[model samples]
Target chain A: MAMDRTEEDDNLPRRLLDGCQRDFPLTPRPFGALAARLGTTEARVLDAFRDMRKDGLVGRIGAVYRTNTVGSSCLAAIGVPLDRLDEVAALVCSFPEVNHNYEREHAFNLWFVVTAPDQARRDAVLDAIEAQSGLRVLRLPMLEDFHLDLGFKLSWS
Target chain B: MTPDPIDLRIVEATQAGLPLVARPYHAIAERLGLAPDDVMARMARMQDLGAIRRIGAVPNHYRLGWRANGMTVWDVDDARVDALGERIGRLPFVSHCYLRPRRPPSWTYNLFAMVHGRDRAEATRQADLIRAELADACRAGEVLFSTMILKKTGLRIASAAAE
Candidate 1:
């Protein structure tokens, strides 16, 4: 009985995240509708999501744009010296256009994305980063994107 | 295609996220000084135009226990890459697959597939599976696991200031 209860508790967040990935009802009482579908109260549904967000399990309930549609973006990397890694990273993060920066395990360690209103603006941001850092930016622009599943299926272990 | 001013405003408003309220869109509409009907209609149109991919929850995979994120880069033959990339993109474990430009000598990888797993071992196994699928078409490949997230913010537009 305890095992059953635990499983039931675990299922709510997983179900909510998996089920609401796309086609989220664009209704006035969206949470209420979601609660009805999940066979729970509206408050409980909201609480579950709130907890997930606070815990960092979910980033946001928002729209994922098709790249180059709303704006232009490209993946860029820099091989910063180990001693000056943090300083350069802070500099890279200073740009509003630079989003999704990561320290990946590679020779070209600092990887980031730059998005701007148009190609010219995007290129300008890249150029600015290069001029400031004095590091050659490895620009890997997407030539083709093979669309994947709209909703990421969570593998519940 | 560039979104008109209104559509751009809507994207800017909700790009961060929808408010976690009973009437999320209605809340957004009020905040943006637009009617609920207008907000819904515009969002639907954006979806139709492929500007908005989908309206949903964006999960932080690392926090969700898929801790190991491996970016597998492949140097595949340019002629056959698109066909192979589509197949690879459809794989259950591969989250994002794209054909990117390659710079010779230092960088020869033109294909990138993001693979997520519970740990390094699992992610490596998944990469191995992709290698087998590619066979000789893939000249070489490497998996670059992220050591840290220096910064991560949702897409932001310069003109659209968040309230």
Candidate 2:
């Protein structure tokens, strides 16, 4: 009985996570529909969503665009000097085209993704970054995208 | 495909996020000066055309306890990469897998897979599993752990193109 209760409790968030990650209803009252399906109230569903967002579990309720469908994009990396990492990273982030910029444990420490309306513009931005930072930019455009979906199932342990 | 004025407007309006309310699309329609059904229809069409992958919640893996993420890169034979990439992508633990161009002399990795785990050790373990899975087709591999996320934002194409 205790195990059954625990399982029921665990399924709530799991169901919420799994349900919302794909084809969220386009209805006016989506939460209400979701609540009906989950055997809960709209307020309860909304509350859970709020809590999840607050806890950082949920990034956002939004649309994820297909890669290179909306614009040209490429993965780029630069080997910045340790002392100038921050300055270079800030410079990289200044570009609105650059969406994700991160420091990784590698010789090519600073990496980012640049998105532009066209291939020519994207390459131009890369060249500009290389010239500004005085660093050789390694452009690694996606030859094939195997798994595009980043959403993963949440395991409640 | 170049998006129409209406599509661009919709993207700009909701790029940050859809309002978290009972009638989110209605709210979006109100802001855009369009009817709710029109907004919904356009969104559905965009999704069908693959302009929008999905309308849903994006979970932050780091906050969900998958704190360690390994950006695993592998140097696989270019000829056989498509077949191997497909197999590697089917792995449950691998979230994102892509075949990227390899720049010689500095970079020789053509395959990239992102594996996430609760800790660095777990991430490493997953990378090892991928190594074993690749067998001989994978000539060399390295797992670059992300030290910090300096900036992370959803891509927002300029609505200027609409005009």
How much DockQ does model 1 earn?
Answer: 0.75
Best by DockQ: 1
Q: Model 2: which docking level applies?
A: medium
Across A29-137, the per-residue lDDT of candidate 1 in tens digits comes to: 8788887887776777788889999999999987888888888999999999999899999999999998789999999999999998788999999999999999999
Error of 1 at A92 (Å): 0.4
Give the residue spans of candidate 1 off by over 4 A: A1-10, B160-163
Residue B33, candidate 2: Cα error in Å is 2.3
The superposed Cα distance between candidate 1 and the true structure at residue A47, in angstroms, equals 1.2
lDDT of 2 by residue, A1-157 (tens): 1223345444666678877887788888988888787777677677778788888778788788778876789999999999999999999999888989989999999999998877888998999999999889999998788885746756667
Residue A42, candidate 2: Cα error in Å is: 1.5
TM-score for chain A, prediction 2: 0.84
Q: Please provide, for model 2 over B30-139, each residue's C-alpha lDDT reduced to its tens digit, 9 standing for 90 to 100.
A: 99899999999888889888788788888888888898988999999888889889988988889889999889989999999999999999899999999998899999
